[model samples]
Target chain A: MTKVALTPLAQSLPASVPFVGPEAQERAQGFPFKARLGANESTFGPSPKAIAAMQKAASEVWMYGDPESHDLRQALAAHHQIAPENIMIGEGIDTLLGVLVRLYVTAGDAVVTSAGAYPTFNYHVAGFGGTLHTVPYKNDHEDPDALIAKAREVGAKLIYIANPDNPMGTWHNAARMQQMIDAVPAGCLLVLDEAYIELAPEGTAPAINTSADNVIRMRTFSKAHGMAGARVGYAIGAPDIIQGFNKVRNHFGMSRISQAGALAALRDDGWLGHIREEVSKSRERIIQIAAENGLQTLPSATNFVAIDCGRNGDFASRVLANLITAGVFVRMPFVAPQNRCIRISCGTAAQMDIFAAALPGALQAAHDNLG
Target chain B: MTKVALTPLAQSLPASVPFVGPEAQERAQGFPFKARLGANESTFGPSPKAIAAMQKAASEVWMYGDPESHDLRQALAAHHQIAPENIMIGEGIDTLLGVLVRLYVTAGDAVVTSAGAYPTFNYHVAGFGGTLHTVPYKNDHEDPDALIAKAREVGAKLIYIANPDNPMGTWHNAARMQQMIDAVPAGCLLVLDEAYIELAPEGTAPAINTSADNVIRMRTFSKAHGMAGARVGYAIGAPDIIQGFNKVRNHFGMSRISQAGALAALRDDGWLGHIREEVSKSRERIIQIAAENGLQTLPSATNFVAIDCGRNGDFASRVLANLITAGVFVRMPFVAPQNRCIRISCGTAAQMDIFAAALPGALQAAHDNLG
Candidate 1:
């Protein structure tokens, strides 16, 4: 027997990760991927200004970043038009979710989310030993009403919904989101994940309301600002809930270089507009490529389009596997119906060209494997 | 009443930080610190190669860092002559400590540490609802026997000790540390924090033994590598405990630039040697400055010196306050006996010169402030 023992909750958790990175996949496949599109990372890259800022901050990394992340919080506050007291900066949205789950979910507490939403959230809930209740998506979009009903049934302490959702690229606009927020059950808090909001059209997000005690909005530089590797994300909520993060967070966890990069990225609106335009074009290209292959595509409000394989999850899994084998990295939903479609992230023209070239052969191989 | 409720454990935690950063102090003081000689950060800066690597990686921030931290972990493994599975890279040692605490100490579990030791560990213990039992320092050194006895008494799940210790800058040699490790109570893990080990004398750390399930050694780029802001730290331990981090860690939380920087920093041994020589000189200079001010300095094995203020915690607090007012940043221990000394981190010649220039007035001001 090992001399050291893990806590019961920790012992019960599986040593599985939410997502395996493309680098790990490449290592397994024993070759580099030709087109990197698996994770919903912005292939368009961060603002030049952000890159410059990170480079400048690189030499100044000997000192610990301001534990409070003061400057970045101030900048984020200005950008969001919320008081600095309403914001809490974290290493990433994943880290923030972990901390949030720790705050609200103790052992056996209930938490609710869409079945095929961000696995990282469910990972945290399970990590904390929270009993999770998942509602299935309604026509690929997260069914907010069903989620609320489940939360009410389970008496969940927290409810999670991601706008411009992952894996399917489906979204609900402000009115629908506000309605969900309004019906968040008396004692439950709504975790409104807006990680992909910047990629969606305007009116997709509700206005910032720091007065509402039951809702917190999570945002990230990983998508529109294109700094996923920098690991910067923030949450906006009521002052009390925001301040509660201070009780459990790794106070000095942020990277100083990332703070500077995020600050610079937030200041550059033109780069974001350019990225939106580029992503729109890439989405169009992905749709056109799917059309050429006689496949239908899900309408994407985010950086990725879901290509419908017009069959089942197993066929789409085969298509995804063949795509990865063909040196193009892409992902798909894990649940049924949605898993019938393989999700592809928007990439640069060259990457799209590579994906376009690989798809036809990959689809033919999947069909051939049907025998 | 707030609609959102924190878990009972989280609600019980106070919203206090372990350390108020120098940046926050500067903001409060309405000016910047002239000598950044606090927080135990190496003001000498990271290796030039590290800075260059980070700068080069700046644009690549669009892609998420490898969730497994493949390259960095492999390099760390080679550097330590351990298998890759023995290492777990984290955002920093602080984050790793939090995860480790979560793994071992559930609510109401016992954790042991030295009084006036690293408060961040205590902070994490409190955050996890662990009952921390601190043994008083024996002659300004961590009392390993006392810690072990207390762990036995309280049935602690974990014991934390920082060699080349923080706040006091004192340490135990490898043989002494190995003895302590041997004495760790059964079922308790020993968290040997070696954050300052890179600056200590040879033989300060015990040999790496990944088979030892009861001990985990944390190493960082923050001290001698001079990349505190980069947020790169790792643990060497039995593969089971090391792999256990995957159960609770933010897998994609590392900054890509930081991964590149730490990998480059680890490769540049000459830079590390140069830093050690410089830190030794700075330590001597700080001792001399303390003597010149009619104060005594503790024997130090790390990059900082703890100068005895010749009175008590209140006096040392006054001295630290005056130093900050005079534009030199410094810190003090939180608990008694050791708190009689003020801690000053090693800095460059220019920064040491600033501390030298500011010492007399700060001393006088501290004396004057004594009622």
Candidate 2:
């Protein structure tokens, strides 16, 4: 354009975009989906108390939130029974992941993640020029043992493993997860993403530890707490490692009303538990609906259930298109084999009813269109 | 410590931080400052209508926002009369600034700025491993010609200039600024931070350029539109360069409520015009108050006025301390010559009354303590 050039790194980076939004697809399709089950959002919505708190705080949008996010951090500390230094709040786990990667991984440094794990984390690694070594999923689950071995092999400075893993919604028990955690090489900091732990059964999450310097566990209000739109998430870790974020994070990046809403959300664990139950029922309904359509369903511990479509990724994609064209918005895995199953988020009884009603017709259409 | 070292770039970054927020100081001081004007927040707050929109969107918090932020960008395009492709929105101008710097700067690359310009910009340069070359402000104004020369001297990749500049609040006319813009070296990009532009006078801003590949003009609703807490800002540049942000930005970083408030704030230009009027009156009041206290006040097109404290940096620090002790919170420039002044934000008449009541006594106490 102007003959100005960007850095070599930036130039090398393809104007590659992260995940393309459902909205973009919807606009291209020229229609709105009757049911939105994509993006793994909590269709059940955030806690009523959080909604009320945001409503209450709506009028005070002029004042900046505490730069330290002091009150919210205090509330989180009390909720987690940890010291304030054990917590660091931010825009979301996605944003925090970027900061942590930037903190530890330099150009040419190695980092590890399960193949087909959260691409956002990978995007950050690529953004900072880190070398990423991805391990394949074992038996449809993220193999933490393989991840640690690869980390040691690669001499990775960081390794990311999401418990109750995305795409598949499969998980390891807390004891086994901790076993993997304990076996990680001393020099590689483990980033255990517990983003879906709240929806999983008890023992699906490892015990909290703020003194562990070699690991940082991330949680989000976006999932079980159901405030995805609010963009609030936190990382819990050793104080020094946690404080490392202060060196480079946009210090005043949080929204004031979000801090207020998160505080209210954390205090309403009763609501969290209730939504967890609803998600469990929704999962069951989704499984039943899949079986009714003669599709196999995976055992899931997360909010979304992956339905095996008895076909390859291309076939699953065609089915997904059929679903979208039928006014039901759902997504599927990106990699092979796993992409053979379409991932559908747990939705309200009515939204699921719409999906349940439409899936049969969509499947028939896909079958009819098959050449 | 686990001794899992940070990257060389991250390790090289200082443990330094941005402005110690007023809330942090208030906590240290054991009482909130009576007049909260240090950060240039709109005391009048965002429009009532905007708050209502955020409240309306509160329960929808469980849904992730449209990642494209299409509605806001479309509205912004219509409002600014530019193609939607020319605008890119992010968490805030601060976040966008970091991303923009990262886009062009690699390790050891040279970036130029005034010695005492925005510290956060400097923070990003250091964070990205860019070497910072500083040119001292000439006559309390950011010397664009000097910056251009430095760019040519060091083969600088990027330069920072804030029209209606921060700290000292001095500005160059649009014609002078355009001349300086024309002189930016062919390889370098100029970052024009207009964070406080809406409150600025008519001639203080440059005409919007849809084809400016060498410069990215930043504008935000943080100052006059009174959405500082909401954390929304956008950059206007050539389409190709604006889309370059796709490679690395946190695609879903913006909060939904924030989008609502910013959209509403943008829709209500009357509220912004009202804010400008109020800011002007407050500026006049600050000037009169400074004269009453026997100090010189500089002309300001932005929301804040820089008052010459009639002494050096040390004396001004003492005066600022006296004001803090007298229960009024104010800040000053951190570096020499400019630090010989105190910067106060435009607040309500009543807040200025509080400031006026405390200034003479604070000045006297500072003088008495000099012995």
Candidate 3:
């Protein structure tokens, strides 16, 4: 009997995961890591009010979540001071990016992003059979000018940029970002992923302008609100672009419990203030630890810091491997000279102590192994 | 300035939601649904253990859920007496169907299903640019033979059947289903959606066969397990097809709280048994209420019962509208002869009372409006 055949595009695509969770690593190693920092999830838990809301929502799990996600969208609209029509919610930024790509990029269409930027975005583009053009990062920051230039050159349909970017935690000021936004090619849509914006410095994000048809900004509760597992993220864009999501999106995708948790988390300003302060302290601690170990650290506007290993990619890889072996979970950028650094997330004092204690030994082990 | 244009396929598609949610209706009506029986969700609620597990998982929402979903898949495998490779978990059957369409149906591919089967499936097929060929339902049941015949006639890549079916709550026995499975056209996959399977009679489902490359069975926690809001569903299929999901699925889309809740719910067979008993009672109550109103109820193998209004689609539509106005959120079939009936979900005793009280008044109002 002839077996069912996959589409030619599906057959050509690789069945590879974008990012492996720490749980998988723990399973492979037969033990849990002493410090959970990989994947850039907030080590600080979500607000107590959010937890309470989720617990209450648990009993209501028999009813499907609102397909429109009305209450949460209303809360977000009021928070952003934008009309609800300008926002579109999804399971997460990952899911939103997939839908966005499907809407704009057909087979053989061109999309552009930074070389070492979010792999998940690239995965979505590839899954849709879109031709991706990568522009290299200039001085560890996503070079917006270069990206716009490449988009124009390639006649790209979409260009992706993550301000306060992942892996390196580097960001551009609002004025610089505005310049990049203004420079976007007429026909190209700029995807500004602000997943880490809530934790970034005040001027890191440009003002929200929902009238701009050329840009869509993605925001997630995963990093700053400490609800990564809840999988709530949204896009702020022109009403037409936001409405276009209904053409292909799974309308009832969001979890009811997650909606409750995110709404509560958004309202608990005191908890957010506490998290910001804690994240700031943790960043300082991470920087101090790097300095104490005689390593240079990249200035991070997000909750993670990129510590330069002062060597090539191979050396940094060894350091990361040793750190994982020593029960500290950390990751490094995929492309280098960025790969010459290891990325570590901000955690509680106890978790940071574990990382600090493990780092010197991990470095020593890497040196010994290299020698 | 030229705005970034959507792909030709996306541009051709209208941005219409497959189902207008009860919440949207409630919003329009400026109130909440008193008895939400439209969506076929279990009002019996999830197991207390599942609720507890979700409440516990809420505190740990800072970490991303296991991308592999190892523990839940392993548990499902053990429960089904199959290998873990045979199982693939998704955000929901809705999301899985979308991914499945993306995998097998490229532009211009043909897919087959009953005409009034599930609008969401049709939505996915259209979203992927697949041409859907639908056969009319036979005597309120999804005619498997007709579906198979159409699949063969059209050289279709997929055929979707939900048994015991939605809207009509009718089903086929295992032997008949086995015949359909055996008759699947070469290179055509049969998507057996068993969303309400647990509530069906013991002999309703065919034996699980992961060796069959042309068939995939979908199961969900939404109905019998009473966790619709958690959005957990799994597919049992050949390992190759299951692995193919990894190519396009959002790897980290599932919520950790949901995973924990589903795991707990699956292990609590007592709660499931209780839910089955409760749903059976509720179904009987609904049938009795319909009979009292001089309406005929269809034979149901699922949680909901379809009450025939003894009139045309327009009359049934009026009954549904009046029901909604009376705060009884029930739905009716979408197509011709079947649209003569209104579908009501099994609910708690209190909710059933509300539905029962509202049905008489709704019927009277519908008659008055029609006259």
| Best DockQ among the predictions, by candidate number | 3
Which 10-residue window in model 1 chain A sums to the lowest lDDT?
A1-10
TM per candidate: 0.99, 0.98, 0.99
What is every candidate's C-alpha DockQ against the true complex, given to 2 decimals?
Answer: 0.80, 0.68, 0.91
lDDT for each residue of candidate 2 in B231-308, tens digit (9 for 90 to 100): 889999989889899888888757889898889888887888788889999999999999998899988888889999
| Candidate 1 global CA lDDT score | 0.92
Pairs with backbone N, CA or C atoms under 3 Å apart (clashes), candidate 2: none
lDDT string for model 2 (A142-184, tens) is 9988999999899999999999999899999999988987887
- lDDT at residue B319 of model 3 (Cα atoms): 89
Docking model 1 quality class: high
Candidate 2 deviant stretches above 4 angstroms: none
By lDDT, is 2 or 3 better?
3
CAPRI classification of candidate 2: medium
Per-residue error for B65 in candidate 1, Å, reads: 0.3
Per-prediction interface RMSD in Å: 1.3, 1.8, 0.7
> Which one is best on lDDT?
3
List runs of model 3 lying over 4 Å from the truth.
Answer: none
What TM-score describes the B chain of model 1? 0.98
Candidate 1 lDDT by residue in tens digits, B223-330 = 999999999999999999898998988977589999999999999999999999999999999999999999999989999999998998888888888888889888
Q: Give the TM-score of candidate 3.
A: 0.99
Flag regions of model 1 displaced more than 4 Å: none
